[model samples]
Each structure stands twice: as structure tokens, then as C-alpha cells.
Target: MPARDGDEPSFAVAADRSQWRYRPRRAFWRSRIVRAVALVTLLALCALVILALVREQTGTEGFLVGLGLAVLPVPLLMAAFRWLDRVEPGPWKNLLFAFAWGAFAAALVAILANSFAVRWIATATADPGSADDLGATVIAPVVEETAKAAAVLLLFLFRRRDFRSLVDGVVIAGFTATGFAFTENILYLGNAFGEDQDLGDGGIGAVTAGTFFVRVVMSPFAHPLFTVLTGIGFGLAALAPRGKRLRRVLLPVAGLLLSMGVHALWNGSATFGGPLAFYAVYAMFMVPAFGLLTWLAVWSRQRELRTIAGVLPAYAAAGWLSPEEPLALSSMRARRTARAVASRTYGKAGARAVGEYESFATTLAFLRERARRGTVPVPDFAAREQELLHHLWERRATASPALSYAARATGRVWVPPQYLDYGGYNPYKG
Candidate 1:
């Protein structure tokens, strides 16, 4: 018999009822573990090889100095990215993988490929200086940006659920670039320290201090800035309707090209126009671009909060959530106060439940928005929606009261009888 217009797909209906249980596919049992292990091993191998190569080039004392100084900015950078992702944090595992890939796999590839290309150019033209110049201005940017973009591409493909938003793209790309910069800094600083040692000027006036000031102080965000353009491209693609294959493909490619172009320009600044030109470009172009992207990321985060406030009221009306959850969840201040209240009331367990509740609800909001926009196919929508709702329901015992209290405490009073249309989203309807 043909299904009616409003009928739920039978499989999706079944998925909702199977909420308390999870059954992984047989392939997950067989292939996924093996694949994960293989990837880890490969990353580890790359890390070891790169460590040996860098150490050999920099020598022990220089490597030690570089390692110590190079680590200073990593924690701060990671924290900034993590803060931007507070609305819908990707799994830590994904961020870890991305960072590792950048530090090891991407760095290794860039070094080896750049070295090979520069050598070839030098041999072909019999001009090591020209080859070095070309490598910095052209080959390095293309190789490095593509290498960093590989990790972003991997996450966008395999971790589609977490990679849906523009902020998500920015965060992931930022971490990857951060890791790459960390490794690259180690090399450059290590080499500078070696030069300082050779010149018997290992103090304030040394080359190491100048290198540190340039790489660490002045332009720490350089790699991240270049790569995030590619991420924005992927993120925009993610928001596109699934049927628009050409848009998805083209957006990311366009982003990659843009990233490569900017990277090349930045690299060529020193070669083409000298120190004054470099500073001019940095002040005129790089700073403005950074400010613009930073604003975009923050604006997108607020928009996400508004979306949650707007969309989740339908769920509240249907009794999946309390009347005040939408309002409370939308405000970060309320969200924090709610967690504090939870902690005071029932200790860490209560706080944990509220935190999980917050995460699940945010994810649910994004999932619904995507579904409504046709970015998520209908067949998959039912299952995912059910899963998120199930998690939310499980934590409601603790989360609901905290959220309600937060609503009141933070002046987020809920006025009811709105958002009731369901917008084709009522899963409980048979």
C-alpha cells in the first residue's frame, strides 16, 4: 500500500522506540577499529620521523630551546578556539585528531614536499637563491595550505554531524593551523638559536629573539588565518541543501583557492617589497581580515543561540521540554548560572547532567534547522532527532529544574502559547 502524505517512515518510527539500546553495524565492529588503529599508528610514525629530522637540523640545545619557547602560545590558542565552540563543541577526539594531523602529518608533508620542490627548482635553474625565493612565495604556500586543508577535509567528510556550522569550520581549522604553526615555529626558532650560538650572541639581541618576536608575538595567527578561509568554504557547503552537489564541491574548492592566494601573497611580501612592504601589507590587509573573520565567528555564534531560542519552543509546547528551556538555553549567562545551580543543588552529577542537556539541546536545534532547510535528508532526520530527544529526555530529571531556575534567575521568563505549528517536525504524531 502507498503511504499517505503525512505518514512517518516506518523505519524512523522504529528507531524512536529503540532509544534505550544502541547497536553498531557489523562493519563498525570489523573495519572502524582497524581503521582507527591504522590512522593512529600512521600519525605516530609521522611524529617520530619529523622529530628526528627537526632535531638533526636544529641540534640538541637548539631543539630544547625551540621546544620550550614554541609551546607558549599553543594553550592560549586552543583555549580561544574552544571558547568559540562553546555553543556546540565538537567531540574532543576530533579536535585532537585534527591537531595531531596538522602537527605531524601535515607538517611532515609540507617539509618534505617543499624541500623536494625547492631542490628541483634550484637544480633546474642553477640558482639556489631564486629557488628559495620561489619556494617561499609559491611552492610553500600551496603545499602548506593544501596539507593543512587535508585535516579539515577529513573532518568535514567523516564527522559531518559536528562539522555543520561556520563556527565549527573555524574552530577545527584554527586548531589544525595552530598545531602546524607550533611545529614550524620549533624549526625556525631552533635554526635561529643555532645561528645565535654560532655568532656567540645567544641573549636579547640574538636571532632567536627576533624570530620569536616575529613568529610568536607579531603573527601567531598567520597559519590559522589562511586555513580558516578553506574552512569557511567547507562550512558554507555544509549548510547548502544536500541535493546541490555542485555548490558543495565548488564552495570548498573556491575557499581552498582563496586560502592559497592569500598565503602566497603573505609569503611573497618580504620577497617582492622588503620589510617596509611586509609591514604595510600586514597592517593594511592581514589585520583587517583577521578582525572581519573574528566578527563573523562571534556573530555566527550569537545567531546560533537565537536559532536555539527560536526553534526549541516547538519542542517545549509538545512537552519534550519545559516551558522555559528555550529561553534559558539561548543565554550563555543563564546556561552558566543553571550549571552552577545544578552543582549547588545536587553536586557534580547534577552539573554534568545539565551540561549534557545543554549540549544535546543545542545539537537538536541545529539538526532541526538543517532538516527544515533540506540540508539533512528526511530518512536520516527521524533517527537523529529521536536520538537527540532521547538524550535530552534522559537528563531532564536534573536538567529541567536547573534550566527552569536559570530562566527565572537570569530574567529569561518564558511566555508560552507560541512556536506551536511544529513546522513539519512533530515526530510523535503517527
Candidate 2:
């Protein structure tokens, strides 16, 4: 064995295989830790919910009534949030946590703070009548919106990779806002029902029922829609060039003020004898505003899709991605089809890798844009960018075999003609 001069080294092959084994073991442990933390957090939130439901003397019937009212609108609202998030899907666990944080932690804190603030303000002003309005309109909107928005801000701080676009931020913020609204509605509904029970057979019950119907049906969008504006600001700020720190701060502040203004106006209009004024204001101002934002969101999403098409040719020529993959990536429908092909050819893991790679590419693009804008600090920018790229490369490497097989089975070899011109081709040339 020692006399073999041209033999390949066995130790090198063994080391390479060992490195591969080490990676999966590390990944397994990391996943286990993440799951453990997620489970613990969820259990704690559930315990809080149980405590909130049981602390009242209303017993099981009362709790059920309250829960019923609270849970009713959740599905519809969740669907709406999902629609908003269609542009860039995020982690479900993070979204759920954001909502729960608002429902439990934010709601509890806001109630306490708003109550204390109203009492202090009322005493100082020597006006008990003003205290009720203070809590409902001024203090409540400011404190509650801020609390709900904090959930999104914390997400950006902790999980930047998960939030690839403004839509992701909006959806996450909307979820938090919805959670706050749901819990608040429950309290209002329960109080109304309880008050009705005390008043006699028909009177209080009818009024409470009417209130619940209006809050649940007509104005379910109130809190979430309002807070989504702030989410837009926060999300945009997060994307701003690191150099424009002032803009980041000011933009979100402006958004918060806008949210407060809308909330205050809504509260003010509700105090009127007729809902006509509220309807009129909503028609004249709020509807138009929301429509404009929706249009902007769609336009922005289209631009992002175009960006992938523009940048991905380089990778296609490098053999990392097929030219056809970029086109498919631009369309959600096509992306789904690609995943189906992957799943059929390989398995769930192949499909999942496709999704992960797509997400990684989107995040990388956002980071690159941020870096170009000087929003990312120069010192750490290169390292972070490289890390993101490396992750994308690794994901592609894992999925390539499956994707190649899938492409062959489907009789579709997606070669990008434009890939030849990616590095240096003059568009002006014939």
C-alpha cells in the first residue's frame, strides 16, 4: 500500500464525507432547539389566554360567549392578511406569534396604560366627562397602535430574512392589529352582554347584539386597516438606505400620526347620532386612501418580479439556475407548477428546497438594494451579503439534482438565451 505512488489519498475522501455528516447533525440540533423554543412560547401564550378567560366571574357560559364573539371574525381577517401577504410569504410561526403578542401582551399593557393615563389626565383637567373620550380616542389609539406596531418592529429586528418585502411587513402588522381588535371586541361584547343581562329581558340584549353586529361585520377592518399604514412606514424604513437614518425615523412617525388621525376621526364620528358622517368620511377619504395603497402594493410587487428576471440571467449562464426558472419565479402560478414538478420528481424535500431557494433569492435582492442605497453599513455589509449568497448557493446545490431530473421528466430543458448576453451584450447591437 505504501508503494502506490499515484494512489489518491483515503484520508482526504474520509474528511470530505465526515464534513458532510457534521452539517446534517448540526442542522438537526438547531432545528430541535428552535422547535423547543417555539413550543414553549406557544404554551405560555395559551396559558395567558386561559387566565384571561377564567379570571372573570362569568364562569364557563360567560367565557364561551366572550370567546365566541372573539373567534368569529378571526378566519375572515386571517384570509385578508393572507391575501396581503401573497406577494412574499413569511414564516407561519412568526406571523402567529406576532398576532398572539398583540392579543395578549399588547392588549393587556395598553389597557392598563390607557386606564392610568385617562385617570391622571381627567384628574388634572378636572373633567370626568373628558376621561372617557380621552381613553377611547386619544390615549387608546396612540398606545394601542404603537403596541400593535411594536410586534412588527420586533420581527424586523429579530427576523429580517423572513420579511423580504413591504407586503410581508403589512401582513404581519395586520395580524397583530387583528389580534388586538379581536381581544378588544371580546371585551366590548362581553361588557355589552353583561350590561344587557342586568337591564332586563329585551332592552340591553338588543343594544348589545346591535353593537356586536356592527363591530364584527361592518367595522371589522377598522383596527387592522389603521395599523397597516404604520406597518407600511416601518417596513419602508427598514428598507431605507442605512445613510438615511433620519428618513427611516421620520417616515414611520409620520405613518403613526396618520394612523392616529384616522383612528381619532373614526372614534369622533361614532359619537354622532347618525353613522352618515362616518360613512361620508370613509367614502371621501379612507376608501380612496386604501385603494391607492393597494395599487401601490401591486405595482411594487410587479417591480420586484421584474427585478428577478433582470438579475437571474447571470446565474442561469453560470449553471446555477435554468433560464426558464427565472420566468417561472416571476409568476406565482408558475412557481407553484415548478414546485409540483419538483415534488413529483423527488419528494417533499425537493419541493421545500425550491421554496427556500426562492425566498433566499428574494432576500438577497432586497439586501443588495439596501446595500446599494447605503442603508447597509459598509463594514458588515460584504460579510452578510456573502453569507446570504452562500446559503443560496448551498440550497441550489442540494436542489439541482432533483430539478434536473424533474426538468427531464417533464421534457422541458429551460435554457435562457439571454444568459449569453448577461455579462456584456450591448442592447443597441443587432
Candidate 3:
């Protein structure tokens, strides 16, 4: 049999296929290991630097107290960002990396760079007070924002697949800034605590309590709000077409500059207009800006959901998806209901499969839109479509019933006549 010429081709093909499978697995694992090791080493180095800096500035007791108190807002901020990202939900690893960069690497860079710049200015100017003012108004903002923006820039260049839209940038930036702020709060609060120790029972209310009240309670989101402007730049740059080279390049730069300007204004407020400056900026600028960004994020999410609802019907017509699927996947409430039902019936595995089904379905919808726009290559489109269809097929028996139930419970009909056209319900249209 081995000697036969015709059989040789088949034997060779089988061997090639077998070899290809193991090769990819081996390469994938090797690459993953290398990346993991590199990331760990980098984070470890940053942690050491940041730890030494903080612990040196704040004594052991103050550092401990700061560490205990500084952690209070971390979970709340994390949960808020997580909630915003519930629709697409970037992997936790990306967020963790972003936070680490902000807390350690970014903070370290900011401290060293800012301190060096201020010292240089002091030496040149012969007036330490004015040099300090210049650093706060000019140096701090530019240095700190650029430092925080490193996370966004890294993700934009390296993890392009995950940094999809403006929301992703905002979330990643927010987390990074949050981490930076956490470390910064620890330093400030701890320093204030040290100052309180020198009060000798003279002051009624300690600086530590006042500092915590101002930073942690009143303005916990200050750093995140500043960094998110830069993130928006990165996100929009990602969305820009290849043809718009200037847009892609300039958007991020503009965003970084804007973030720096805002940060500078915030830092210089005390010097520029005294104590009322903070209140004026907070009311006249910060609150309005935050509100606008929140609106934009929510609106953008709605637009994405609408894309799913509108685009997937074509696939349904082609019999690649259940008619109810697009409707179910479009509604976040329905998606949650679907997962709950799957979990209740078929256990955690079923719930996980349903979640995958939803994600794959959303990805498929976006892919189709991209394909129609000629943004994706034909072979890639076909390959991805086939892959997504296969997964949906595998889980359809379990996921379909759950999704159908979700559609029913959530009052999302799979029938025709969409209401997104006018932004109002059209119950009679179906």
C-alpha cells in the first residue's frame, strides 16, 4: 500500500494537516509565555520603583495607613467602568495592565520627570515659588497626562483588536487614571498624615481627614476624567479609515494636548483665581464635560446595538442565524435574561456557551457591516463567517430556546418594521 503512487498523495496530505495543527498550538503557547513573562517583569520593575518612592516619602506607619484608606474607592470606580463595558466587555487582563501602568509606570514617570523639571526651573529662575508655580501650571499637566496616555497608546498600537471604539479608550483610560490617582491619593494622604503627626494636638481637625475629604470623597474621579480625553483621541484614531492618515495621526495628538490643557488649568486654578477657582471650573467646565461624555458613550453604545439589530437580519435571511437571535442579542436585558435562563437550565457551561454565542453574534454582525463597506477582505470575511456559524450551530440547541424566552420576556420581537428609524416604539408596525 505504501508503494502505491496514488496513495502517496493522500498520506502526505494527512501528515501535513497533522503537523500543521501541533505547530500552531506550539507557537501560540510559546508566544503567550513570552508575552506573559515580559509583562510580569515590566510590572515588577515598575512596582519596585513606585513602592520605594511612596514608602520613602511616607514613613512605614503613614504608608500603611494610606494603603488602608486609599483602597476604598478602587472597587467603586472599577465597578462603574465595568458596568459601562458590560456590552462588549474587554478582557480583565487589559484593564489590569492599564491600571498597573497608571499606578506604577505612569506615576513613576510623572514623579521623576515632574520633580526633575521643577528642580531645573528652580535652578534657572532663582525663585523657588515661581518655579513651583510653573511646574504645577505647565510641567505637571503635560507630564502626568502623557504618562497616563501611555496605556492608551500602547493598547492602540499593540492590542488594536480590543480597542474597538471610543468607549473602550475611555474605559481603559479611566482605569489607568484611576490607578494613578489611587497611588497619588495614597502619597498625598500619607504625607498629610505625617504633617498631622507634627500638629502636637494643636489642630482640631487633622490634615489627613481634610485631604481624604477633598481627594477621595469630593474628587475621586479627577484624574480619570482628565485621562479619558486622551483616550477618546486614541479611540477615534482607531476608527479612522486608512485613507484618513492625517486624521488618524492628529486626533490622538490633539486629544493628548487637550488633556494636558485641562490638567494644567485644573492644577493652576488655585494660583490663577484663588480658592473659588476650583468651584468655578468644577461647575462651569468639569460637570458639563462629564455629562457630555457620558451622553456620548451611552449614545455610541446604543448605536452599536442598533447595528446588531439592523445588520444581523440579513444573516437571518440567509439562514445563518435564528430570526430571534439578532433581536435577543441587540437588547442587553435580553442577553442577560438569556444567560440566566441557560445557567438555570444547563448549568455554568450552558451559560458560558450562551454568552459566547451572544459575543460571536455581535462580532458577526460587525464583521458583516465591515464586509459590506469593503473594510474586510473576502477570504477573511468568509473564514470568520464560517467560524461564527459553526459555533452558533454547536450551541443553538441550548441557546436558541433560552434566547427565544429572553426575547419574549424582554418584549423584543423578531418581526419586521424596526423602530430605530424614529427612536420610538412601533408596536403596531410588526
lDDT of 3: 0.82
- Per-residue alpha-carbon lDDT of candidate 2 for residues 1-430, written as tens digits (9 for 90 to 100): 1111233223321234334422345575468588658756864775486347543634445455666877889998888778666545777988888888777777877777887998998899999777877677688888888888788887877676576567776788889988888778767776677667777755347757887877887778788878888888887877776677798788778888888888877777765425898778777876787778768667767777777666655556654466565555656665666678678866898789877777766666666666666766665555554554555565665454444444444445554554366568745457
Candidate 1 local lDDT, 1-430, one digit each (tens)? 1122233323433354434223345465466778889889999999999888899999988888899989999999999989999988899989999899999999999999999999999999999999999999999999999999999999999888779988888999999999999999999999999998888884524689989998999999899999999989998998999899999999999999999999999989978889999999899999999999999989989999999999999898877788899999999999999999999999999999999999999988998999999998786787677777767767887998899989988889943444454775655555
Q: Candidates' TM-scores?
A: 0.91, 0.76, 0.88
Model 2: residues with Cα > 4 Å off, grouped in runs: 1-60, 124-126, 199-205, 272-274, 377-430
- Best candidate (score: TM-score): 1
On lDDT, the candidate that comes out on top is 1
Cα lDDT tens digits for candidate 3, 1-430: 1221122212322234334322245575568678878987998899898978998998887888788889999999988878778767888999999999999999999899989999999999889999899998999999999999989998888787688777788899999999999999889888888888877644323788988987898778788889988999987887776467798789999999999998888888866778798879878887788888778778878888998999988877766566787889999999999999999999999999999989888878877776765546677677666666656666777887899889878889744545454557665677
User: Which of the predicted structures, 1 or 2, would earn the higher lDDT when compared with the native?
Assistant: 1
The best-first sequence of candidates by lDDT reads: 1, 3, 2
